[model samples]
Target: MKTITKIFTMAAAVALFATTSLNAQTMMETDPNPAPKGMGFKVGVGINGGVFRDKSPMDYAYGADLKLQWDLTPYVAVTASGGYTKLIAKDNAVDADFIPAKGGVKVFPIKRMYLATEAGAGIAIQDGAKTNFIYSGGLGYEFGGFDAGVRYEGYVNDSASTTYFRKTGQYAVRLAYNFKL
Candidate 1:
């Protein structure tokens, strides 16, 4: 699982650097209008489905997140998100649910394209409402009012339901609509 996390982290870093270099080259050749520095707000909701890395084949997971973004610069923003996740045990129909809240930075390496990473915490309602640390990283594109992306997320806990780092984490494809407010 650590190996998988390292691989994903490296991949994300490489993609970010490559995109940043390309954006720099493009900027040198073309003068694009600057994005407003004034504060801005955007709200979005997205859904994702994935498997727990440590869980057996029978465990299926899905979740939804609501996000609030504050654009501080053309290439930078701050984001806060919270959501609910459900893990279903296919064998016995047992279910575990969680609520996660996290905050992170969003960086746009190119127009309408972004890389974001965040960390915070989560609460598992089962097993006596245990709390765990949470984190995620993702890449996404925003076109007009629509956004789509993929992210890897994990909770750092070793519970009877989710055996801590054993499952590694989750990889999910996400889609959302961001409304500028």
Candidate 2:
């Protein structure tokens, strides 16, 4: 499973690079506007909520994130984000909390619509808990400085027997308002 995840991540990176290069070349050749659209830095604040998988002890997860984005072209952007999330406990289970830091690429295939993939570490807030690997993929629409996306995110543990960091997944929705920087 790890191998597959690695392969997928690499493939996505390569695809993003290729697309960005192509788009840059095309824009350089024909774009008339001196000040291009979607060519700047942006900062955003977002909140998310979701349900964990049925087998998990957590009932729901909710969080907020701060994001920085740099538009490479009208079609591609790079992003870095960090956020706090809480895994609300089910009956008799302990709640878990984490801070996740990630970097990713967003590719716009059509106007106002984008696909994104991100990977990073989820640092556990509980003492003695191990950090987990996190990955997510999602699609969203951007309009009037607001972006809304839904994704499937996973936290993968290296050691399944550990108290925390067990493999878990969730489906989450994020809504953010961006400010130009």
Candidate 3:
């Protein structure tokens, strides 16, 4: 399918270009000088866990997230991640299973903690319903190239045809480290 190819295409491109190029893939790489020596234009791998609500908040849910991080600015970066969140129910439907593409601004107001806010759109697949417009916000932390962070996210449909509303969402703590090519 086109969608599958598109997704793989992006991943392969990232891996191919990233493995051969010795620059950060995210924010800091774009800057002439980066505070975090190995920051900016970074492509990192991470894992996280949190809660995912279906159409309603009453649904009990849990999830694991996997994503790639890119810091493209002296103070900003973009991350793309996908996750499978499951709802505890009879049919065992996945509460949140989506490939989210997000971008936001980040500031190192203090060491380790990053003051950040982001806006992004994603395609969410849940219980046979395909939703769009996934967004989130929050602060994060980093140490020795390892990052652990969290956020409050919202999901909606691309068009007005969406029945889903805002729900308090969380992500697993992630750590991002860099390696030399």
Candidate 4:
């Protein structure tokens, strides 16, 4: 949809601007503690956009989420997030919209780089729509206070008969701003 495209474009611009501006500042100053103090909590808000897999009636997907993360160690963390997503339908098809709540783990193999996995339920928002099981995995990098990740997400429907597609997936990019809590 046009709205989704516009939002995605705007988010990309903002991210680029922030990254360029902050990179210069960070290079000029080195913090003694680049990582957070031991075992802390962080909160983040993000927006995502992606295209649906082939043969799907949906044209694109877009969403926003709020996440809470607890750092278990410098190399590990646990996260919980909830979000609203909309899969824009192709012509003559109905849209799919849901709210997803997920919990997962993040492992930092190297400084500021991480791998993540998550699974949860996606609750349908439309009347008579069925719930779905959702899962995702991704890799990302953190710089300054921004986290950018690319992920593949899938949705599975339990019932055989449904108004929406039974199995669908997308590849998405998420850009978030995080802060310690």
Candidate 5:
């Protein structure tokens, strides 16, 4: 039964990955990147990364997410994002994979330039301590149905830290598809 389940899980993962890649390609091929609908809500997927310091060594982490956002003003927007992540080092001692309940505020005060901040709470993979207050901010450009973004995310343990170097922070460059609903 375990073997069957493992195979099933692997097959499912492959299927989903293929689908997303194909969808992205199709959109790129057919769409000339027109401006998305304005004054409405948008939702899409994104990827992220971060690193943490533990007793043993440092762990490098990567994550993927789906986000739903609402335009609160021409210069402000709010987003709900959740997704999977993994942290790796010598061995998988901590929960590298997690689906964090997170939110962000975005502002485009200047043309073609956006600034945003985000925070969240989540359960990590395995038995690692539950993470609290995931936060990030970045700059981005909105181009038609596609956006290019650069952001940084920080992961903090439930216990407070006295120094900045003790926290886990990941910097990322992301390209995302935008849609209206």
Candidate 6:
């Protein structure tokens, strides 16, 4: 599908950017100036858990999240993440399952602490395979190779037929480990 292609393209671009930048950094090592602490690049993976507020019948879904991240600089980074979330129900007819994919940024204010945000698209496959806009923002602290944070994420389902937004959202806490590539 076109959407899947676009997502992969974006991911390739990000990877290419990181590789080129790292190579340039290697070339710069001969210069008098050197990268500052935490100024290099890194790759990360981790797990997350949170509440997924679905539509009325299957409200308050809870699920797990998996994430991948790239730190391009001491102050800036990119993240690619995906996860499965589901709603509990007495019957299968009213249950919900969601698959979400997103890409976003992280900004570190003091090298070890960051304010992060991301926006992308996701597919809600359960009800009717509806595609929607997704976004999230939060802050976290990092020390050693570990990161911990809390973020609020939402799915926008506004279409021509509907005008209201904020129909689904989630509040989650995340912990991750990052390593330079």
Number of the predicted model whose lDDT against the real structure is largest: 4
Q: Which pairs of residues collide in candidate 2? A: none
Error of 1 at 181 (Å): 1.3
lDDT of each: 0.76, 0.85, 0.55, 0.87, 0.68, 0.66
Residues 1-181, candidate 3: write the lDDT tens digits.
9999999999999999888957666754353324345444544456555554554442444555555556655455555656554433324433445556666666666655676665665556555455566567777777665667777665565433232434345443444453322
Q: What order do candidates take by lDDT, descending?
A: 4, 2, 1, 5, 6, 3
- True-vs-predicted CA distance for residue 49, candidate 3, Å: 1.6
lDDT of 2 by residue, 1-181 (tens): 9999999999999998888845334444654322237579999999999998888767899999999989988888999999999878777676778899999999888777889999999888877677888999999988888989999998886574243646788999999999888
Q: Where does model 6 exceed 4 Å of error?
A: 1-41, 52-61, 87-93, 158-166
lDDT by residue (85-116, candidate 4, tens digit) is: 99887886878889999999998887788999
- TM-scores of the models, in the order given: 0.70, 0.76, 0.54, 0.78, 0.65, 0.60
User: In what order do the candidates fall by TM-score, top score first?
Assistant: 4, 2, 1, 5, 6, 3
Q: Provide C-alpha RMSD values for all models, in order.
A: 20.9, 21.4, 24.0, 21.6, 23.5, 23.5
What is the C-alpha lDDT profile of model 1 across 1-181, one tens digit per residue?
9999999999999998888845334434542323345678899988878765545533667889999999997778999999998766555754667788899998988777889999997777765546678888989888877889888877666555442323346777788888788
**Tens digit per residue, CA lDDT, model 5, 94-172:** 3345667888888877764688888887665545345556788889888766778887777676553211123566666
Q: Could you tell which candidate, 1 or 4, scores higher by TM-score?
A: 4
lDDT per residue for candidate 6 within 149-172, as digits (tens), equals: 988877676453122233567777
Clashes of each: 3, 0, 21, 0, 4, 0
Q: Is candidate 2 or candidate 6 better by lDDT?
A: 2
Give the residue spans of candidate 3 off by over 4 A.
1-34, 37-39, 52-74, 78-94, 126-128, 157-168, 175-181
